[model samples]
Target: MTYTFTCKKVPLSDSVKEYAQKRIDKLGRYFQDDPAVHVSFSVEREVLCAVEITIRSGSTILRSQSQAVDGDMRGAIDSGVAYIERQILKNKTRLAKRLRSEGFPSVVEDVSFAVKEEAEFDIVRTKHVPVKPMTAEEAILQMNLIGHGFFIFRNASDNAVSIVYRRNNGGYGLILADDME
Candidate 1:
């Protein structure tokens, strides 16, 4: 597996690089031949340390990030890696389903999909769903009932359509699409 560590707004240190590489090495078992891991470290306001980890195997990509305000870069990196692993574990079922449904060939098959004609974007594959008029609260409820991260609907008040999605911080986010223009 190949590991790429990038540092931003922080001085590169051998200890820091070695520590990140060591942590990344633990993820090698998840892929064949030590999947390449991309690790990025950055400092913000000279107080907050951030670490991002990205692992890619074929078309499957898993990523996670973490931040620490106490200036603990190692802790931030470890936390980010752990969060990524947790995400992988949590989405294992969905990942397996996507692999099966999306024809994500077996790990043994190293064939590239770039040359395949079917790999191109297909308009017909786009799902056209109708947006019903409802309040943001209603959309949130519906999204929760359907176990979906997002729900699109027309606002009952203004008759404009919008989207409501779940946020990473256990909150809901809204995307308003104004047709007033």
Candidate 2:
């Protein structure tokens, strides 16, 4: 497995890298084959310690981003590790439910449980709307005018299909769709 660390805006010392490496190795037991792991540490305006870990195994991806309580990198790494572990555990539970009627006696050492959920979404209604070209602001405005959570439209800037949604906390989020190679 390859572990890559990206330090943004702050020069991470050797001690910090060593600390992060240990934390990352703790999660390595979950992968069967070599997986690509990317860890990024950054400092944002509101967030003191910004640590994000992304693990890519085959076609599956597990990511966790954590912020420390008081700009503590170790604490942030710990929290991120815990969060990703929980995610893995959750996926394992779901996969186990489908794999066997009875649960496993020990903790699973595989992370591919998240590869295929196998579960299907309950779809009751489907709608087809005309995708008109518009700017991000216009999409947000359309979403608000319709009192909908999200609005889908073609982007005027790039002519790509995009979605704009109202975030739970605040502000709006734009999702741009790209072609698959």
Candidate 1 displacement at residue 172 in angstroms: 19
Cα shift from native, residue 3, model 2 (Å): 2.9
> Tens digit of lDDT per residue, candidate 2, span 5-55?
999987888898899888878766666667798999988774588899998
Provide the overall lDDT of each model, using Cα atoms, as 2-decimal numbers: 0.76, 0.79
Position 11, candidate 1: lDDT:
85
Please tell me which predicted candidate would have the highest TM-score against the true structure. 2
Off by over 4 Å in 1: 94-181
lDDT of 1 at 77: 83
Worst 10 residues of 2 by lDDT: 96-105
